[model samples]
Target: MTTNATPRLAPGPRGTFLLGNLLDLRRDLIGFLRQVSGEYGDIVRFTVAGFTVHLVTHPDHLRHVLQVNSRNYDKQSHEYRPLKLAFGEGLFTSDGDFWKKQRRLMQPAFHRQRILALGEHIVRDVVERVDAWQPYAQRGESLDVAAEMVALSMNVATKSLFSTGLRGDEEVTTIARNLDTVIGYCLYRTMVPFAPPPRVPTRRNREFTAAMTSLDGIIYRIIGERREHGGDTYDLLSMLLEARDEETGEGMPDKQMRDEIATLLLGGYETTSNQLSWAWYELSRNPDVEARLHEELDRVLGDRLPTVADVPRLEYTNRILEETLRLYPVPWLERRAAATDSIGGYHVKAGSLIYISPYLTHRHPDFWAEPERFDPDRFTPERSADRPRFAYFPFGGGPRLCIGNRLAQLEAQLTLATIAQRYRLRLVPDHPVEAKMQVTTSPRYGLRMTLEPRRPAA
Candidate 1:
């Protein structure tokens, strides 16, 4: 409603006069941005890839831009186009009416009830994965926790979203692996955060396209089967196929279906994987926190597999995961452009872009004391009441908030607790825990660690 041009919140000096701080951001993105927050205050500006962006740290301003008054903003299509090539026109990137229809129709699949019903399967599958890791422990092999988390999360998505038939399908792995590259390539590489189109057909891009082809074939066949069967199944695909207008009965078309699958695969896989990796990293660092997590699990399920009902009681494990996300948000920052005449008193040119960095916002000194310190206690009941709602936005906010938010938390809590109940991971000596600020802020060197088996309960 108001647009104030704060001369105080201005862009930095880097790159070329025209080019801006593009290279600076691309070089060491997290460090550079953190330094920016330290130097210029939270709500400042900088250039990247020839675009001017406003970095907002104030929770109120962010809530305004992302949620409260979000009609003025939409998902950055300039950003989503690369994904469009892989996903078509699905939810993650699509805008306006089409996005609305897809959002509403897709709602039931991720409904709280639906996700809770599938929670047992999520807990069980994760336990099996951890059991498989016992051999790695036996061989005295170090672990790439990042890759393992990705693999686990991908399987979780398959189980809950796709149903039993799609779980562990060869085509599904190909899709996930291909998407792993595409996300890191396109969203986290350039100073401006985009991957260039393949010009002469390099091995990386070719592999992505090939994987997409296989995935598309699988999804297409599934959609075709859904059409033939006439809305018979309650799985995600059938939900989308049967989704209709509240007033007019119209289902999502093939193109939208393709985009949604791509969106889900990309958005679903990376964020959860990165979160689990970081949680493992933190758990390795803080043995005290890990022990407490173990205590909670021991008291709760006590050797039995966790049920959906047990999730709410797994509060400590969930807090550890939430704290992990606060330290290392997968997306790092979300960019959007103004759709209307203004933001506050500033005359936001219709096409002007803006950035709301949860990475920066989360570490605000005012909201979080000793912000850089890793303290999960902030999430405890009394302390959590001290902050505003959008102050910690790992899954983002608003109607555009991640549809998979609850589902992701369910998987993380269940998986980490299930693993902690048996095996404990020790940080490997001299291994660097470097973060790659790519599509998601993944551990660049991979989270290499040693595993120790817990003493069995008497």
Candidate 2:
């Protein structure tokens, strides 16, 4: 770990002579990373398109990159450049003083009290959505759980962001579809190093542009309306408009507001939805976990709707979410070395890409016993006390940690409790459930499930 020592690259797979690990990476991102990290150890170094990349998986190493020496690692890298197409210079892709300023201005919106208030609306919304699933349950028809969660999460995110949900199901579907297009394109660009720029007008580029335009039109229209007709609103949009920089006493400009809003919508909606989709899949596969979840709901909720006050008592429900995140972390962490550094006794050059996988770290045998098991008890205080903090960072860590972590958790916890109270989601037989790596982790093939009603809807 001493920087003064002679520099040495970390051990890693010896890929192709010309392309290095590019083919392997593009073929299977998550699987490739997991294989290399498992084979070569924590600080695995490899080349992709002539770039020296390091896959750091140890908890201590992750802590160094994410927290202790976080300043040395930042998002100003090629990995984040593609995201700028959709997110612009928002918190997700922005760095340095600007990111700090935005984070400060927006931090209050996600505070404990703010999320608590939002939790009530989230639960109500989830209850209505879950009730709507009754028809499908009664018909015994398989429902695409992935799409369902995306739509539900979009509604929740829209409400939290604007204090009003999307106009209707059509608009929600349209916006969600556009978001997928733009995000999928961005991910494609990131993975394909030599892909054409946006200006090149490739078929995919055109689609990305169209999707972005649609999204921008909707977002700008809302911002304009909100600005012209300012009202007493408790959503994040209103807060951003009202937020004044402590140093300059200036409010966020429209462009900045748009970027931040886009970031939140993308971050909050897709991540929560994917996590929920996976949660249902896991629940279906593990009836024991589902039974315990139902037990907790019955004891704590008892045919009543869950509220923010009940969140604490729904301990098992929260653990399920934690376990899901551990198994399949969305938008896995990536950073570029801003300067030369030493990690896990290996030298990391400036501009070297550092990839950390919560998926892999969560499964590290040293820290997690039977790491692949879907046991929520792994997150219990007694069990987790000895684990490293970075061993389970689905939302990341450090100053750049996700601002809406609490809100996302609350949304998932309440939505799960609400739905579990009414029905159990069982994956359709012979259905293949494979994790797809996009802007966030998602099911490669949409998750289709048959819902079994547990009790009559209220």
Candidate 3:
């Protein structure tokens, strides 16, 4: 069924003469992508300042780039350079043999057993955080659900990484504020091709440098304390310190440890918080789905907090998370062709930028029935059996998949179940929630919602 004909460029929008599609892309990234993918077929070729870029939305093509011929495409693209400014050469930004070794050392810490054991900590944190919302529910005051999720997720990340939460509210607020600046700057740099380099003393660069410095001070201080008073601990930091290379039998260097910790903090909290925020947004809009979720949680969990063993039984809750991811996949994947290649009969030249958008692909009409509709039942085993493997890849696919995927899922499932057991979040009327593309897909105006207390099913 495959074609071996001479390769040609894929069809795409004829962009502006000088800047290509840069203006349209900057104007509205997700909308522009959806527009083009709807008009053109799967492999849409566009130019940005004469740089050839291919937006591959087909599942088969995505598999070819992310899995089948993964070695031919790598993270050496311009997309990841901004990330390296904050993450350094950590797992998120590293490649080749160095990446392989790092993955090996960190793999044991993320094992299923280890993650399951962390469920107690995750649930406890979620319980404390959600309980604090009682005042909001009692007074019927609207709270920014987006900001709440971010703070809660950051607390969970710190607990998991260091086995302790931030020292106090002020510290947590400071870290979260700085992270916003850092992430916002990185996103601006990534989207704006002509952005000034970090070395230049621009206001953005200066702010980014200050924010990174504050974050590094915290990270290195943790590393330094661990080294001074080393002890047995179950946290990720301890594991990283103990991890030794099989070949060289060496522990991670301080600089590398800082980089990895920063990467984990950035990756761990941001995506899950955004996903949870979106889940609340959708549940408020779809009462039936929300009702079913509550029914399942009540039937399975009764009056007790959810445990790791109960995750499988909470099928509907997990499905809600899956559905949310389908609609709002955070990270848009980018890779560069290390060598000349062919994709769907299109000749992809060496060094060409290959863009595979999960946001677009997840909603591909060919694969998803009523793709925009929020339906958790679509993920049932019977329904999902025939779907393309690469079609629903929110955590991405293949070897370079997001390392903390399982941990993120567990945290989300547990947090959602715990909070839904106590209260239901209702979106504020006419709040105008819109998906904004940044480092992640998040609400442009933070999700403001009021909470209603739910009684246990008798």
Give the Å shift of residue 12 in candidate 2. Answer: 1.9
What would the per-residue lDDT of candidate 1 be over residues 1-458, giving only the tens digit for each residue? 55464433354445577767766665776677778778876456666656666666778777878787777777664566565666666777777787787788899878888778768778777877777787788898988878888888888776655664463557567768677666655653332433556654877667666776777777777667657765444456656666677877877778777778778877777789898888888888888888898899889978877777888898887888889889888545555665644444344445556766777788888898998777888899999886888899888888888899988888888888777877888878988987776567888888888888885522
Q: Write the per-residue lDDT of candidate 3 for residues 200-286, one digit (tens) a residue.
A: 999999999999999888888888888998877778998898999998899999999999998998888889999999999999999
Task: Give the candidates in order of TM-score, highest first.
Answer: 2, 3, 1
On lDDT, who's better, 1 or 3? 3
Name the runs in model 3 displaced over 4 angstroms: 1-6, 456-458
- Candidate 2 — which pairs collide? none
Candidate 2 local lDDT, 1-458, one digit each (tens): 56485677799988888789999988878889988887899889998877789998899999999999999998877679889988988999999888999899999888899788898889888888877888898899999999889989999998899876356667777778888898889878787768988889989989988998998888898899989999887788887888899998999988889899888888879899999999999999899999999999999999999999999999999999999999888646688998999998798999899987888888888898888888999989999999989888898888878899999999999999999899999999999988877557899899999999898888
> Which of the predicted structures, 1 or 3, would earn the higher TM-score when compared with the native?
3
Model 2, TM vs. native: 0.96
lDDT by candidate, in order shown: 0.74, 0.88, 0.89
For every candidate in turn, the CA RMSD to the true structure comes to: 3.2, 1.8, 2.3
